[model samples]
Target: MKRLYFYTFFTIFLNFYANGQALPITEVFNYVIGTNLGGQGGWVNQNTGDEVLVQTGNLSYSGLLLSTGNSVSFAGGGIDPQLPFNAQSGNTVYASFIFRVTDLSTLTDPNGGYFAGFGQTATVFGGTVWLRTAGTQFNIGINKATSLTENTWLPTNFDTGTDIFVVIAYDLAIGEARIWINPAPGDLEAVSPPTPDGTANLNTTRSSLNRFFLRQDSATETPSIVFDELRIGTDWATVTPKDPTFSLEDKFKDRFVVFPNPATNGFVNITSGSQAPKDIHVYDVLGKLLIKQTISGSRLNIQNLKAGVYILKVAQDGRSETKKLVIR
Candidate 1:
């Protein structure tokens, strides 16, 4: 079978032929699984038509839900109302999310469980992306620099629902950070042998810009899983697939906002309904980098920074919106 479809494009074109230069990965958001965190931030409706289905803003709760109710098992770890993103800090930063792992032994350890995923409170930022269940054989990672050096045992072998990508890249001042999880073709599942040594040290807290949680607190809140597009970049990615301006049934596009969301003092009140021309960028919280300008109208002024959490990329006309700011 053409060598099993060339092992599913060898982990999706292995970064455009290995290093020849590729990973400028950028798309920021694509919540297409169940849709809900678009503006009000809340969604968790997976019973996709088998029975017992609710509709309202497409189901609101916390975002990231391609199918909820089939794999119930993660909740004790705490992070249900925590599907937050919109973060980017200087020098080196990369985040990739495309979950579909319905089940993976509810992985837990020195890093934490439900397939292991932490950052917001760990070594720095977060780490852990490995899954499996027959399908195939694949290994992946992305946390390159910030290994707090805990129980360490980052393994990979995912093939649950299919599109399972979790890539993270960072190289701030040689702090070192690299993570890769390429499993799309037949789904290369990799388990064991690649542990206690994958990447870490994201205890990030210099500038502040942390907020990312997938399986929540483990234990098996499974929820069946099915997430699409959860990108964060500094470049170093591979999960390309874009072609949609409006067609998910089309329902009057044009949405954007950024106000009093856990934010304090500083400046954070960017509301929009029309006016167009809207773009603001600021990052701090280990992923480090800081600032990515282009502002026009509304309101934006986080006052010289200091506290933590920042990410508000709003683009009008071209249709783009990303919110999450907290500086205390």
Candidate 2:
């Protein structure tokens, strides 16, 4: 919340859509792991690896940093969570997270280790979306065993003690992937401009994603970085971060009540507390606006929406509130 206060309302408005909607992603799982948005535990479980979870305010979005410490060679892993693994395939899968690095200067490994990203291992081969130090430049690379091919951004992006947000989406069916970087906080679709969107063609068979890892591959390098707010899901919006205060109870203390929550009939009924909502916006997990309806009474007919999770945003008198809705 400290860094967030520095933003002006104008910048915040620019980050979201005109309707004040953001992060359309469905969010299969968001693991802040006891530090930030604590919940049902995730990578903090130490499913694998020896990385330590330390609490720090230095460039941390959630006051937690996953450190790889110093290594002698290439192989020291930081945070390696193998369980509760996402098996999504067929369409696309996305992974988004925030990372901060102390330095990217000593990293010289070409293709051995990874800092953070997703990976899939099948019976024979595997693929990954990870960050590495290419000389003095930081690169986001992808590798797939099927095509025996690899792709990465050219050496241009550099970082030193900065919090960087990365979002990557992989189409399992077509074996294609695209990456967006440091979108306006809540924006999952914003790509790095000037430079073309980071694109890659993984010459491999599409399979269920088996693992997501954060590692410091080069043992010779002692650079330590921290990762926070890691998420994985099916679409762009599913993995994107959304309304920072949406998850805080105090923020929504006596807001409105969204009923028929697990809407079995695809219809949602909303009742505001004391402050009436001027407009109600419904968006898919990917942050795509499904429908915008004027508040006639206090209900919305969602018969057109498919079965899944949706984000509901209510704007009243220039103030806005968000809630997560489920359609069964």
Candidate 3:
């Protein structure tokens, strides 16, 4: 069934692009099974035994179920090719995700389990945020330019079941990283993680970051953690979990217009009448950001995009608007 769906979608996608037709606009990947494009984008399942399960959960969203034996890695494929954080780009990166343990007691690795985080090949430039059985908590372990250190455990009690949202922002320019955790899905943009839930200084300098890892560490770990809504981007709001109540279209209605909706030349013009938008972002139906540009005029060049549906977001003054677009 999965193969059938993939081929079917692939056929449609290829046909549109091959013939210069625009693709459709839809929400990007949010780890929703069946809807998730990770399998095709580069996510690898490295589980030694059982595979990650797609199941309904406490938060009313689809989630990935994992056992002590399950592991996955985003070090290679799953990320969009247009993303800027790839080691080749040298951009600061931010990652956030929501997760919970079905049974916290199952995480009994005294040595700690590398559940999620980013890392580079250079010994001096990797970091892993993991869970250790000793304290039943999550901690950030960073490898800087010369030294590697682990921060204090997060100020949260772990028992059996609870939902936690984690946001990590790493600035390569300063060689520092920070973490934010929320008990529930709150305004991540407005509500900062409580004082005790974050790290102050991660005294490590990095030159390049290669890939993000998920549960790919010591095998001594035996935890069953479930995760949902994993996001990685260059900014805070881009990686934060979003509420389903609001559609992307609602946020960007009538703000800007993209002409030649089915762009014949793979190029479109963006006009906002008088108020010029400060920023413009182009994303695929899967929610993968293809391009981000600071614009002062009314022209957008999408010559590189395959014919498909896209979402164009424009930011002006303090307001933002989203609109559906097509390309041929």
Candidate 4:
């Protein structure tokens, strides 16, 4: 009995550690629409001024999980949101997010400002993403730490009102950072990581990172921007999964459907090409598993769930797909 208990405890500990370290953070901003982002979804308000309001709709890139809920937009002042994660040390940390510049005509700072970055604390930021006007367009740049100027800028200028996907990787071992803009979903899965469009050296010797932040500088320094689908992990693929739309291995890709999405009647009907029994799991915006069961029929009772947005994962024959679920 003693040996069996030891084995069971070891197995459970390994499983927990593996799952805990797989994905350090994922934020879809799937909160109530038209609310401030600070108090919701593990984010804390660091300063005061303009609130980052959650707006309807989300930004998307091809092959990504269908974006759900809403996005947060910021324009001016010093108000920002900070989220702390497990401190990562001596390894590469990767972060990816979708953003768009709605307006930049108000920006006057010649040096521009950082809109997102990794931070050791609410004030110490690095692996910064910067934006500055380039003639009628704008350019995105990256810096390893707090700097007056960007260490490297993309050669191309981008137009306003266009969605851009950005990925940043910071290597603590070497104190270096790399940035890629609009890279294909699976680019990081290659035998070697894809070449970054911009690279920078961490001018200061930093050791660990524990927080992520979204910034809104003064009106003259920052543009009106919207951000969504922020994810951070230890490897490139963890933060930049391939677009599901192009997944040939997804057996239920085009054959599955969920009805009564706004589920007014406290139930949802799922239909798929195959009638095989499916394992169902429902998760909230923070990735908490709220419901889990198996179903052999189309209808699933969800009356116990509160009114809000959720993620529904359906698995059959070892294949699975996730869809956005909203309850009225």
lDDT over C-alpha atoms for residue 294 of model 2: 64
Clashing pairs in 4: 63-243, 63-244
Per-residue lDDT tens digits for candidate 4, residues 238-285, read: 787765556654423434589998899989999876678876888899
Query: lDDT score, residue 295, model 2?
Result: 72
Instruction: Quantify how close model 3 is to the true structure by its C-alpha RMSD in Å.
Output: 20.0
Where is the poorest 10-residue window by lDDT in model 2?
A: 64-73
TM-score for every candidate vs. truth?
0.26, 0.48, 0.48, 0.67
* Global lDDT of model 3: 0.50
User: What is the lDDT for 203 in model 2?
Assistant: 63
**TM-score of model 2 relative to the true fold?**
0.48
Q: What is the lDDT of residue 209 in candidate 1?
A: 32
Tens digit per residue, CA lDDT, model 3, 246-281: 444533442466788888786788775355445677
What is candidate 1's lDDT per residue for 229-252, written digit by digit as tens? 554544432222222332332222
Best by TM-score: 4
Instruction: Report the number of the highest-lDDT candidate.
Output: 4
Q: Which residue segments of model 1 deviate by more than 4 Å?
A: 1-97, 100-111, 114-127, 130-167, 170-175, 178-224, 227-238, 244-268, 272-328
Error (Å) of candidate 1 at residue 12 is: 20
Cα shift from native, residue 169, model 1 (Å) = 3.5
Candidate 2, residues 225-260, lDDT tens digits: the string is: 655556666665555535544443533443567888
Compute the lDDT for candidate 1. 0.41
